[model samples]
Target: MNLPFNLSPWRTKLRLRSEAKAQVTARGSSRKKAPIKLGLPIFMMIVAVLCGLIMGLGSIQYAILIVAIIVAPLVLLMQSTTLIAWLLVVSMIVAGCLQYFARVEQAHWMPFLILAVMLARVPLDAMRAAKPGERSDGVDLLGFLLIAFVVLVFASALVNKNPPMQALVGVKQYVFPLALTAAVTLAVAPREFWLKVWRSIPWFLIAQLPLCLYQYLFVEKGTSTAFGATGIAWDAVVGSFGGNPEGGGASGALALFLCFGIASNLALLRSQQISPRLAWLSNAAAMASIFLAEVKVVVIFLPLALLILNRAKVLKSAVSAAAWLLATLAFVVGLLLVYQVLHYSNKQTGSKSLSEIFEFATKAEQDTYTYNRETGELSRTGALKTWSQENIGRGRLVESLVGYGPAASKGFSSMFGKGTVARKYVFQLQTSSASTVLWDLGVVGGGLVAAIFVLAFVRSLSLAKRLAADPPLSALAESCAVAIALTGSGYLYNNASVNVSSVQLLASLAIGMVFVLTRFAKKQAFLPAVSSQVKVVKRQVFRPRIGT
Candidate 1:
């Protein structure tokens, strides 16, 4: 019925609309195919490689490092889960051995290898929006604290009186291990990697035990021992050999990290996720090794960790008084065991009894070594006393602001002989960690470090409480929290723990895992409920037939 003229007009309008749609589609496809901005990334990589060379690595080393950094992310993406999982264990084992292979200055470079591996992934993590069911990393408060810490450390080092070269050397070590937190938060993928990290803690401890045992016998044979406990009581780990344990007294102690293992094993045992027999056996063995280490700090703190971790059980209305009574009894028994071990060890080492040791610790002599013939080990006595005297005596600590500088205590080596207190104690005036902090970074820098530690401890406690209703998740948080809190021992008396190989590695790992676990817990909280029995599906990759 329509006229030819009206039909022609309708066909022309429809054809115009189809042309517009085609133009829009073409523009959209063009945008999608545009390449990522390579100009900036290529420039940045070049700058990084140059800086690596400037920092001290040779040209060959820089090339190797650059390649490793660039390739690490791709390696991570393509590698099977199991291989990635084992990297942490190997890293810590190698980290622990750093003390043997390199000097303290050289040891720190080892952690950056782990950092390079993590940094290569940052660009990828940022640009690639996470796929469903995939875990991705983002910046959090902990990362900020860490960055602030590094900056403060660097600033403090600049003001220090140590030789320019020495202070510069020390600053790098300060910055190195911090990379672990960044690495964990950014580079890690699925949850299983973290669990594997936790599992690796037990194995890491296991690997060290034989070395500790051999060192114990080495102490027994009157030979020089490696560090820490043997350096303290001479007979602390195994029993007294004829010779005294060697090294700076309180500086070399490992009580904090040994407590870490004890707390971790206890968390596993209480959660009951593992076989009952295995849990009990492993916990007992770990506790024994920790006790056998004979560090006084662990003796006190390990039981406290048990007490805090079990508060959930104790607070339950359904739980009876008998359970509470049993816990108290168990704690007392543990204390008694520690006491007996110390007593027997003291006798063989030619050290005075506990009462006499206390008398020496309590009394302040004129900054002299307190020798215990019975134990044959020299005591780093009056550490706090010396600090107090220095603070009250000259008011040096009061005036220190930016601090004398990192390793300022050792700065005196250039002016004074090596035997002076400044060189010997690694501080200008103070001997303890508090004094060291004041003498080194002063308040601005040291306060931030202190705050970081306090926040970590508080976060740990908070996370543990929040996750208490979920057993495995709760245990992971609580264990890590306990370990992180105890690492305050690094601030205990000297920089030994700070400079020591194992303590730094373990502390970095513990705090990193704590933050990582916090992220995991939040995600898991919103997930839908699933059955206890999961149906495992074998992944079958469908590659196209090349011939076809």
Candidate 2:
């Protein structure tokens, strides 16, 4: 990445060198710039819009407006790919939040904006890299496998009769996450670009976490409508991304991602790349997320991640983790103590004044699984029950082996079971990413998922250890290590670990950073970037006399 030799620091010399080269290039070159022809695509898109309106597809004027809003800004900002990329990330992260606040109809198109920006950069990234004789990272084989999986899901959904659009919509959501990976691998280059992305994680956390908290606290009380998501009911936590009646939306899962981001902060601190105060504050917020947003999975995963990180300052991490635990316990105690203090009596239940808040969370957690004290048997409920009844319990060998295809599992759980208990479990077709792959993609899907897990786990761990020998790369290395672990754990629970745009963007950037670090792994802190041979040669011809 460094120059072959040191050029003088003189700005005058550099300016003259640039001027002479421009004159020579103007005289020698006959090449003309190519015109960008966007007319055909524009025309086709308009035609499609018209056809949709003619065909009674609800006019699609809003859809066109959305597309225009996304496309116009991108075309204007095409020269600023990195800016566009960051903007896209911001848009994706905030769209749900915006939807919650403004009550916007559909915020999903934001991810498409993100994808369009990603695709647009492919050419520009290639051009910048070409001068140095570098080619793209190219689509990795795992990327191919992931894409194939998407095709299978989409194809399956397309042929199904039950609201096929919904099925496609569900399946399409899965792609944006992986699309992040493809975009990162394809476009990310040079140390500066990589570091910019590495550092951007904390910014994203700082920007989004507060908005999430605000919505959870002050905003949730305003109206019956949940602030960030639908169906949160009154007094539920504002966990819009993973909103249910309780569990405070998906805050706990997001907090877990902050935990992962803190790993990066630790790395940057070691390398002296970022300020210590920023690192500490960001890590503090990460610790707070567990308490502010309650989820059992966060309770399980946070400690495991810290243990894996196994920093030199064990006491420091332990204290942070302890504080998180204490805060969470305090919040629970406060919730209960206040409810007791109020002491309102409900005539229906024998118990006195059980808060609807507590009731919902308790039921949400218990509704899916029942433990028998006598036999030590646990009955399944919720998404598990759905998977069990349709794909597992009654499915024929072929269907079980392959799955009913995408959201087709949804129909299997459409009605209640014979009794109330059985029916409760059969409420919906909700399943984990792992479960879906296993049940829907069948044996082939299982094989693909397994291959991805084993490869990413082994490779990332190996890379982390190697890079940890140095301080700067350590940050990147550990981030990847944690992401790999998180990704593996997602097999059992979808949790948007690798299934949503915002998280996927982070995970993909982590994968991309790993690739960059691997290249510069034991090298010096900085490398001088040199120009192409053609530019260097052109600069040499314009040497001015020193007498003047």
Candidate 3:
């Protein structure tokens, strides 16, 4: 009836341990039982209902809904094979063609839907494969950027005179949060998803080709109401090209797609596993889109693509060099042809000829000469300086640094006596590419933000280079990176900060993915001891040798 003095404490401790073990066992049983009886079936039913709704919709709606549904799963499938990647390539082509045919919004949404779906697959796949200790640092970085962006928005709100900074706050909150989510989700995606995303690029351009052709042939002379309803006179008929003097509006986007496609095709051509016909088709479509877009700067992508191609060993040294040289010459000739066509067209329309166009383009020079003739000294140069003077420093250094609140600079500058000069000038230099970074953030803020942006790009490029040695994902990453870079350059004047451009959004997302992947890859290289142990066990379980 009596236990030993020392054994009494031991029995109590044993009883406590037994109780704890039973509780742990009960919790484990409940956790295991709950998912089987409720969670999985509920999830499956929801998916089924969603699918049913998508399928029941009309063709257009169904198409859109289906794309949205498929994107996440397809992105998850990226690491398995090149098929999904190729599917995306086709989707992109279809989207492009739609855009070219004046279905601008549809074109924007189609590829976006596909890319989004593909991106969604990434997080699912990552969750499936990720170990306990292998945290996604990319997500952390995205979170940090989101926080910084929010802080900047509030900071800008405080300093500006505009009361509508609140509205701007709303926009920042929506876009950056979504962007951050998308980027983080995509970063952890499997390599296969990235490949499928790349494969879709060629198809995207192919789709756009017809749209561009349609615009060039039929829509060139017509002007549509902006934002779908409001009536406004649009005298400018820029065609598929979005907004360069020589028809380059959509040119940047088209060119970026083409560059990525071309690079990917060349890489594929080297692989005996891929059919030559597919490669030829992809390359042809890419070239045609670039030619049709007619952006002079697109020529820059050729060399960059070639450099990537050569570095990836997709092409031999001599072949890459020769191809690059030919591309350069072709681009120059194409530009000249474009100029001549514009010149001749102007003359036929009783407008200015080549010389007159040049004179117009160089009006600032003429203005300077006239000013000097009158005052015997050169007037302040550069569009920024000229605009600054005219506006009487409305967008002064302080305003530039902190931004003129939100709605303050939304309208044209009244103080300049220039009537309305297009609110774009407030955040974008008129002569420079349409970029808000410089205008909104000024030199210092813009530079700092840009440096962070560029760092992300550089890291992606480096990762792409390293992955290039692997073939499957390398071509995909390289192509996507190049496309994003080409697209980013055009934003110099377009106020990409506003999230108005789908291409800009895509570029930002792609860059975010790259940054995330780079961080993940670096961390993987230095796994902790516990992670290494888990990895060893995983490898053994997953990668059994033949006859083992």
Candidate 4:
């Protein structure tokens, strides 16, 4: 067949080697050829702006349709979803600037923008990648449950005569990442790219430190600025999550993200997935951020998260034991310093001892969830009480079964009419994620959501063990499992998923990565030899190429 080149075996071997080298060179160059296509997103933005111009649809929100169209093709053509994932992460850090400084009306829609992309990308990728007559990425039990929850959301909205846009906005915060999980599960990317993305997360955590410090030192507590809402308590130290110029900041969310970062680095270190030095540095950054922010919840959430994700690997070696001990010591010392800061921040006229500070923190934590009957104070527990009684007490049996509607308990005032829930139970709007889910989706929907979380955590923990050889991937599954548990805990504390972009986006990504591992397992079962050969080729291609 190759007589035109050479008939001799040695000559043929030489020719084949050269061809293989050429192929490798071409493939490598192609990867470095150009960045993923941005035309799709750009074109969508143009269309959205034009729509706003023509229809007066408001520049802030051009609606979900425009963004969905843009996201589908980008995922299909891009070699990896890493860039898109980053687009979500990096944007979150500077979201405040876009919202306040730039006066971008819909800067808050960044998560939804990414969500639209993920939602569009998943179906498009699934359709494009699946072979004819091949098994589709069938909806699993969890998937079915998620779908049922979404159906309930929509059904509740329709039944209650809620505005479509209001319903969309209401449920977006809670469900956006779950939708993203579906996309990330099917979205393909190289292992190296995923690792790079994971490694960069710590740097993001570190980056928050500088801004946080500056805000803590220079920015007066009551001064309003682009960095964040200063008038609100602890708002001056809200890292990068900027808020209203009047008085708002995501100080709690910042604390949550930093605590999660600390937990992740600890988990990675315990498993030897990351080095001691890097893990220490990242944890230091996280602890420093927590100190500057002084959210008070970290002293509870961080330790709980660490305990839940604790692995047996930490006790297996002397070095691991030492690292864990040092980490614990660092956390304790950092917490003590944070308590000092918290005491000062309260503007106590009298000198307060360390014990007093501890007592204050404990009381504050209790007050957050405490319901006082005499004072009529609406804490998280109080909100839950109100929500449970809202539908059932009124004898609205059908409404109790499905809730008032989607977005029924959204915190912000809706442009759409102040419906029944908002009119009657407005105080419960800004409470915890659990109360909102219950208020909006009823018992059945909330139960389904809870089941989904439990199932995802169990499955991800199992997947982590199965992926023992791939440390980064295994760590990812473990991290996701921990994240799921933390998020469940968060439901009792705050609207972690709904209001906190970092928690929402990162948690979804981790869960999606777990499912991605599942998909990889499926692929391995079918094409084990192909993966091994591919790995070998990948190794060979990186060797020094003197000629090519």
Top-lDDT structure, candidate number: 4
Estimate, for each residue in 375-463, the C-alpha lDDT of model 4 and write its tens digit: 33367766776666666787878877887787776545434555457667434465777877787778887798789888888888888
Please give the lDDT score at residue 70 for candidate 4: 53
What is the Å distance of residue 122 in model 1 from its true position? Answer: 5.7
lDDT of every model, 2 decimals: 0.54, 0.54, 0.49, 0.69
Off by over 4 Å in 4: 1-83, 100-105, 220-232, 269-276, 313-337, 342-377, 414-420, 522-548
lDDT of 2 by residue, 1-548 (tens): 68888666677798999999999998778667779999979976886676567447664435656555546655535544354365446544666564455544345456655665555555665564454764445656655666676676666455433354545444544554554555555453566666666677666556556765655455333334443333222323333343333323444346557667777777677788789888887777655544444444554465556655664445467686677567656655664554444222323323335466567546755776544444332322444554556656764565555555554433232222122122233332333556555445556666766776566656666666666656656666776777667756755554354344555555555555555565575343223223455567777887676888
Misplaced by over 4 Å in model 1 are 1-141, 160-164, 221-254, 313-349, 364-399, 410-432, 468-470, 493-497, 525-548
After superposition on all C-alphas, the RMSD of every candidate to the true structure, in Å, is 16.4, 13.0, 16.4, 11.1
Q: Estimate each model's TM-score.
A: 0.63, 0.63, 0.58, 0.74
Q: Say what the RMSD of model 1 is.
A: 16.4
Candidate 2: count the clashes.
6
Q: Compute the lDDT of residue 328 as modeled in candidate 1.
A: 66
For candidate 1, write residues 435-469 as lDDT tens digits: 55555666665677777777777787787777767
Give me the overall lDDT of model 3. 0.49
Score candidate 4 by TM-score against the native: 0.74
